[model samples]
Target: MVKYLEAIRKELDYAYQVEMPQMDDWTEIDIQPVIRKLLVRIIGKMIVGNPACRSEEWLHLGEHFTEDFVAASIIMRLLPKWLHPMITNILPQRWRLRKGLQKTRDIVDPAVLRHEEANKKRARGEKVDEEDSMLNWVIDNAGKDQVLKILPEIVLVMFVPAAHTTAMAISNVLFDLCSHPEWAEKLRAEVTDVTNEFGLLGEKLPVRDWTGKLEFLDSFFQESQRMSQPISITPNRYAYEEVIFKDGLRIPKGALVGFVAVHNQIDPEIAPNPEVFDPTRCLRKRQSSPEERDKHLAGQPSKENFAFGYGSQACPGRNYAVAVLKMVLSRMLVDYEFKFKPGDSKPKKYHLMEFIIPDPTATLMMRKRK
Candidate 1:
């Protein structure tokens, strides 16, 4: 994942310019659709490599698979549990999910065979493309017989979560920045200073360390995420072996258990003045205490933060997600000036059961910084 940093960085620098219009004046733009497209392309570059990243079919699949899955989930949640088995057959979203799965094989199967051949070439002491896409890396590391079984799952797992979640997160961050316009200049200054240190004249991708230097930007993003309250519950689990608690409460062997995520994010004890939007809150803690530093990083999972699940089973691709978020925020802050359209402030978010999703119809006006 660490080795893919440059590829992720490099892809965003190109994707943003392509997806975002070069508006010279304030323009009414629906951002979520654009963000959805931008994330798939950038994430695709890391997942499948060059040509596939730009493929129409691959990009279409990457963008919509999650939407169908989410729709199916919401529908199932609305119906009784016993009816789910019956509902799956008639559900349109379920059919789409199956169609997408069928299509996944068609697209990924050929790519796997190609990368497998590349692996054999490298084993024969032959030089191959030095720029190893994640496909190549997965093939190189997996057992020979496991290649077919692994690649498609890897493609779906990697593309769906990373693309969808990061897109929502980046949209929330940008929307927050627009709502509180004062922080833009400050975050932009941090981006400017860091990119200049890396000798990037807006064309080159910065190394991981360069993105790390924008601590102010990091804090702002973390705060925005906290305020967004993206999910209501997470780190969901089923207790396979239940036992008695110290309080004398007992749970049966099988039970669904999970943390109430919103409680953690907004708990006053955990976040001072939790109701207020203070961009520097996390940064101040990071600077004041060594113990808090690493735990508070944007994508890092910790005991209190539930955005990325904590511990060994934490979201494996979080670091890559954070890197892309930083890169896109850095570029957007530097190249564009944005604000909500007149008569519109922060667009209200939608709630579906435990999920708090950014309004898909949210719009903001943005123009080139001149």
Candidate 2:
């Protein structure tokens, strides 16, 4: 996926122009929907490549699948545990999911088949153009024979979560920036310095890692995440049977457990002025222990932060998520300016299930940077 960042970058530019509102003057937008469209297109291009990436039907599935899924999960959870199996079959969520899965197969299955056919041609010693995107990447790694059986499922898995979570992350960060515009200039300056040094602002677009050098931006993003983690508890585990701990702690069978993640973020022992939004926090940590630089990166989970989960089950997509986050944010900071729509400067976050999501209907005023 990292190898394809350049392609992702190009897709983002395309999506930005096509989907984002353009005006010399400030324009208020319900930015979340626009961002969803932009991310879906970019994710589509990365996952399956062109035409499918731009397909309205494919884009609609990418955008809506998770909404239905999350809503369904909430509804099911509200009902009795015994009713879940029955509800799962009859609920509108199940229908939407099945419908989306079919659309996913309809779009991705043929692409996978065509890729396999192209591979057969190459095996016959016939020249064929290389296919780019995660779909091809997965086939190469998973092998053609094994992947064909579940290619659409693989694409669906990648597309839904990637689009929803990343879009939410972007939205939360923008809302943070809007709430605290004092940090905006500092972030913009860092983006400009890094991009200019690497010639990222020009058409040539150097093939090197510029996002790595934006230390302040990285810290700022980490800080934004720290301030507004998606969930209140994490590393959720189920006790299949009764077990006693060495500390005399005991858990009954069928018990679920998780850490209170919000505590760590706000505990003054771990952070000075814990209530403050300090963009320099992670950067200073990274600097203090240069050997452990990656441990403090925006996407990496630590003893202090658990937004990405922990252990082997930690989000395998964290690296890709972090990469896209920085790249897109850098471009946004450099090319445009944004803030809350007047009188909504401090829109409060609302809860959905255990997740703390930004106000879904929030608006932001954005204009091209001069």
Candidate 1 lDDT by residue in tens digits, 1-370: 7677778677876787788887799998888888888889887888787777778888788889988988899999899999999999999989988888777777776777777677788899998874667777777677557876656677787777788888888899888988899988899888888777666633454466667777998888888889886677887777899889999998778988778877888888889889898999888888887786675788788777887876787789887777777877787888889999888877798888877898788899999999
- What is the C-alpha local distance difference test score of each model? 0.81, 0.81
Q: What does the lDDT read for residue 131 in candidate 1?
A: 61
Candidate 2, residues 294-330: lDDT per residue as tens digits?
6688777877888888888777777777778777787
Error of 1 at 23 (Å): 1.3
Q: Model 1, residue 213: displacement in angstroms?
A: 0.8
Report how far off residue 190 is in candidate 1 (Å). 0.6
Candidate 2 Cα lDDT to native: 0.81
